[model samples]
Target: MAEAVRHVQVIAAQCTAMGPLSQLEKAARELHDALTDPMLGGCQARTGEYPSLLIGDDLTPQDIDKAVDAVVRQAKADGAVLVLALLGHGFTPPQRTDLYFMVRNSTTQSLRSAVDVGRLITEAADEPGIDGVIAIVDTCHAAGGVPDAGRLAGGVRAGRSRLAILTAAAADQPARDMCLSLSLARTLKDGVPGAGPALYIDRTLAETLRDQVSGQVIGRAEYDQDPFPLEGLWLARNPSNIANAHADVVGPLGLQDLSQSVDMWRGPRRSPGRLTRSTLLELEKFISCGRVDDELDSASRAWVDDVVTALLEVFRTKEFLADVLAGSLTSDLLRSAGRLAGFPSRAEGTVPLRDLLEYAVLRAQPLDGAPWKGLARFVAALLHEAGISHVDPRLQEWARRLHLVTEVNDAFGEFAEARQRRALRLVVSLVGAWTEWPEEVDAWLLHGSADLPLHQRFPCEPGGAHGVAQAIGAAMMWARRELPHPELLEHVDIAAPAHLLARWYPEEEKVGRYLLGAKYSVIPRWSGRLDEAEDNAEINDAARKALKKMSSCAAAPVEWIDSDALLDRSALEYRLSTGQYDAAIGVDHSPDDLEEVLELLLPFAPIVLWPRSGTRPDQDQLRGLVQERWHELPDGLAAAYRHRWGAHQHCVACLGDIRTVWHDEGWLEFCRPFEYRVVTTPEEEA
Candidate 1:
């Protein structure tokens, strides 16, 4: 129902965690005064009761909710618009979606006693007989309230009032000051130069986003209201301006005609009246009340329901909403209608997902450019950013079949690109991959997409490089065929015993073409074996200490072991026992270096860089590269190897000279895929 908003009932809340209470209290007071007083406020003074103010260190979340409900009821009875402001610290709980306004005795771990912003919006919008509702929230995640508030716009509720929301948030992070609320109060008192007969919250929000309001903090506003042709419910009158604000050519600065002029006051920017998912699901209900539709049949309603279900799966998450509110959404993503571009438009505000579809179907707007894959594309992008990608190709096909109004990104193509972007390294180990250690050829099994290993037992002469290379090569080829693309296989890290790693394996794709080190990040690990070896519990304690030294900023610096000291194994072991080195870099390697220097260095030093035994190009270059690229760790070693590849372009065998070995016993235990052993009970066996 369209109601002419008269006076507004102001209800402002302030909750702070150990700070000066005066600033918050003053900001709320200025807002309330601007809404009630006539001269500076620009509104006629007419009120039966004073504005409600809920302020304190003693106020609980329950106190805030109860007070808001009471004020909303009073506003409904008086037929007045409600101006509700929430100012304080907002907390997003661990791994969960909801944004909670922290009050007395509130904690991040639990939110049973916190004031939910979405629930409060639902409360005000659902109240009957209220002329209008306007909410101003200033917190870290204030923009998160936009989608929920947009849902109640003339749909899904019998008591639908005109709803307008302007929620502000700091661009940097967790709001430290009351700049937003203070700026808002000051703006209401001192009206804009180009404003018309009335000043609405939309104009103020635009000012805030542009940083025209305050210089202390840069801000973004998530604004959405009922699609009014002219303006939203008036917050205050234009303080004192001409009957009509206009712009005329400045005769001194312009070369154009002197009489040329343009109207400065055109009112707030126009919106497409974007319909949200909540509105779409109950479009029939909206029609029965304020709107009418002759074309909305049973088939159409069923279609909308199915469409909403799919959209909800993609959009209904704290992660998605919060990310978008933080300006993560792009114009190309919402590129359904030509004019409908940005997430929250610089001029018109947010373009809800269902806006284009609603207009296309109901208003009979043209839908030629729209594609069905927009949602799929958006999901793929979101998943990629969050380090996730697990959408079924069939559901993507289903989206295409229904011909939903949005986009057309190839699911398989996108997934392939995402895998490459992730740069996932495959873990191909003889003992780890196989059910029965590495004895005979067995069937290959691939688990899902991405980092999961392929299992199979292969027959290879123990420590025979050629036979082992071929077995690993066969398994890799099988994995690429089963998965999306070969490029997704960034590199392979083989898990095997010291004997296998000691013998440099040749590339199976071409026998004697190049060595396995040409693969760059082809690392060797033995933690899997270490975990299975006797006295593993003792080994775990040493592993933790090694990890601590690597991660510590003040740990002993990396000291290179002298190649001449290779003959004195006792001296090397004694020097390492001093705890003066967190990492070990070898100048040169011999046939005996692996067991002598490496074995002693393993339990103490976490990072080890060495030249493979076959090639001895230059110890000086290896040492220089290690010194320059020590901080980058795994990636640095890969880069150094690539540089060496270029240096030894004339020699194919030397391309695989440098090898990097990273053994983290802590990480190895943490990522053990199967933690439980299968036991056959007697009753089950029978």
Candidate 2:
């Protein structure tokens, strides 16, 4: 006995309450074309009041119901898989939660006259012998209409038949005009050509339709029963399916197809269009399941090459890189690729390591390169882990062209000033390969010399000046042991002094004096001159010891200057009284000396001192002096003196007092008379 062939039947209907001007008619035409297309193997009977199942303008509620009934009856008789596509305007009545599909004669006031979706599904479900049902709804708030339809259909089916529902939007979302319909039409057109034998809507096709309609109109699919039975049950043979069956033999050609599809739909910006979690999961599974063994045939080789090419394309995109950093789809793909690359334990794969290194090098090729530092850091670490003795040509070129050592020095300088510290950190991580590249290490030492304050010139591990100092010390140690270049070692030695100078001379300098004064001060206890021979011997011995220690580390020869003049109380007093402030303010005096000088000078001229260190004279003594002599000075001179040093009130008062004294006494009154008259020039004297 021969069995009868069961077929698939498609019934498409559109509501046109807005008449000929309505877009529902156009949506209806598109749905009808998609259904009856040869690829779908849909049966269209011409027995109804309308020639075909497409219900549009002039169709009343009664006519729609009759048409729907006839289509269902024919499909039931043939035991066919039935597909229902509804495109129309939908209505929600005031104070009502339910939605309705409006018929041509239906009015806003008489929504009950419209087709209730729940009732329509119940009618379809009552019919016997229908294999399965796929209802695609394109009306506004179509998802809101689905629960009722599913519930009503469940009662009629009594668990005997299968039902699947696809809606254009969620329950609360609206379906925009033409967007849902156009996407649906396009999805159906594309999906039907890939339907294998049995010709019924499957999960793949349903998901494909959902992906296609996203952003334009968000759609969802639900099934009343297991969906596995419906897969590949369509009547038409899909050529693409035949190709996919031999996917392993074709190698990675499917990836190329996927890449092309992504490019086509990704729009002008090449954005990550509608790449959903499901799509990524499917791709990952495909790659994982189709992975070949170590031995490669021509086809497998091609497959591996294409896979790498596709990944490179993905890595180049900003959107994809963001996903990679976020540990999203790209991360997953890389992990799977990594497993295939022979590292199954790592989450991020190593297959793309070489490609990423090359990409980073290319980006860093220009003089002012904009390399992705994070990627570069990863590549450097990976190479270091592999114990590579020599640098890759691409990496070497990047280092050579960009002068990465100089970049690190610049970043370190900015970091010392509390600016962009991350730049320094990134550069440090990227130069992990410097040990393998001797030229780069030498370059770093040479470039580091140009910046003053050693802390600002060397890479530190986030600690600060001390951290930088330690890093430089460690580098020096390494260079002495590992580096053979004499010049490089010399450069390192020179760098050590900059660090020492920074530590010792940390204060700001004005002229030859330090703002914070010298770190060590000499306290003179003797007021009288010592024996010349003993003093000279002692000073020379001390100078030699200091010079010996300094010469070893200093960049140039160290020299000590000698002076014959002795520092005594009388000379100090004379300099202070005469307003020779530089000599009076000792080279290494603390701020207290400035005060003592001002106190001594109060009895002499109205002196305003500008010392090398910019330290002001003692405030209290100056004020007391000014107060004591306030009544003796003219008002104009006192006011001028006060105004001149008013910023430091004590200095102003001292100036006022001194002006009173100087005005009353002559400028030379404090100078001593010459006691010794020269008799050597007796002839001139006579």
Candidate 3:
């Protein structure tokens, strides 16, 4: 028995066409052939009957709305993969130069205003089980085609989304219509679709089906009815059991026999094509579980070792070789290759590097750790293509060790608490390396710059500007490892991270700023006049007021205060620079707090120690005391501790201080930052 036929639908919108009329005619003809071709095997048997429509005129707002509504309704009911192709004239105004899709209605002679196509594509993503969608826009459209040209080719990115866009021009240039529409027609006629035949979805499907031949129904298996009018190519093929069931009967058939069958099937069959419900159920699985996954697994380390030797015997034979590669596949092959350089991890054994590198080239992650050398090199490739990087040794080493640091990082960053500690050690190790050896560490943070303002730079995510600053601080520390404190400070500035801390800490931004401004200014400091401090007594009084404010900030989750820890570190850096570390004492000393500040400020200071005693330990200790008091500390302070301290161990101790510390069956019964005197627990502490 041969494979059953299936149906598919397409909706092409040629909104902007600057190309010659011949080319548009050619594209239209090609689309028709693509839909009907039998030799090309393009059309699958669609369940619902709806003629594929190609709208070639400019679209107005009314047209756009109608199109969307119709498309949506059909999409909901038919549940067929719909492809819309746009080609036409378009231009962005000189004032607001961003290109938009130039849509027009059949009746409207003048062009309607441009609608941003990005929004449309985004909307399309929400449609369910739509399979794959391709948008081919050749116009002066902004997404990807050239500017002012009839075709633009640039917009659309690959992701979890099933939609793909191919632009005719770069963002800056107008799309080139030259011969594209005709070329597309000719391409479809010849049995291919993309950059070349190898890249064409139609060609790929042909190859997939040809490989499945067992000589039973050779020429009977065609994609569509004809080759001149292009349609969305939908492949229907025999299942493994059926194809192989009669294999013994057809096994002896060779290329010559297969070719003969192809010639015989060139004529129409006697049987009216009908798909069984069982066959439909199976076909559903096959299309959904396409060939991408097969290609990936075949190329995988685990599968390669198992199947390679056997496959080598059939490599030279087109029929066998094609069968080995055909079928609908998952996109995971690309994703996995992109992420790991195709290095497949296994519980059974290690994989070879050759396959891993091939995977890397396909996946676009740095192969062999080449990106860590410097920021310039790391970002150069990906800026052009998203989610691809070269292998950089240092970066690889860091990623490899992220697991260990994650644990402590979770407890400290106090972000989304309660998870396995993230790989904080790798970060620590990297910073240690950078502080210890600048020459050895060469890297650029491609996305976040350390120089940006704290508010602008730091997002709520842990990996935001704050993380980047910490990473830089670590790198600086590695560079200044052997230099004297003053010399090292001169070479590197802690201001970036420190200022972030000051800006966010509630007390530093509010009360602390108020008192400091009053004590130190003849006028507003930004207006530029400094007043001399009358005595240490006056400064001490100001410091105590600031301490009260700092205490308030330390009591809440660090996130509650809208400042960067880096700023606090920077302010502390100034104090250390002027021999005022003694004056700014009394703050938290949790593991999370210390590691965060150390990881944040260590490039500027060699030794950050916890205070033995002070009016305010969190205030005086600043960086150190925060590191020491890990378990009890809140969010931002906790993150600081993890970066500074290796890990948090031992247990939480509730000691009596000013206030009585009481526990109800191991439940904590006291607010933090305030002192406790009588310590009592109804149950044992962990």
Runs with alpha carbons beyond 4 Å of true place in candidate 1:
1-425, 430-454, 461-463, 484-487, 506-521, 527-531, 537-557, 564-568, 574-581, 584-593, 614-620, 631-647, 650-656, 664-686
TM-score of each: 0.33, 0.32, 0.26
Best by TM-score: 1
TM-score of model 3 (CA atoms): 0.26
lDDT values for all models: 0.47, 0.38, 0.30
Give the 10-residue window scoring lowest on summed lDDT in candidate 1: 249-258
| lDDT-best of 1 and 3 | 1
Provide backbone clash counts, one per model.
Answer: 3, 11, 171
Between 1 and 2, whose lDDT is larger? 1
Task: Tell me the tens digit of each residue's lDDT in model 2 across 342-459.
Answer: 2212112111333333333332234554443333333333333333322445445544543453343333343333212111110111122211211111112223233311222234
Residue 568 lDDT in model 3?
63
RMSD of each: 23.5, 35.7, 25.6
lDDT of 1 by residue, 523-613 (tens): 5664343334444444445555656543322111244454555667676666556544434434345545474455565555545556676
- Ranking of all candidate structures by their lDDT, best first: 1, 2, 3
Ten contiguous residues minimizing lDDT sum, candidate 3: 521-530
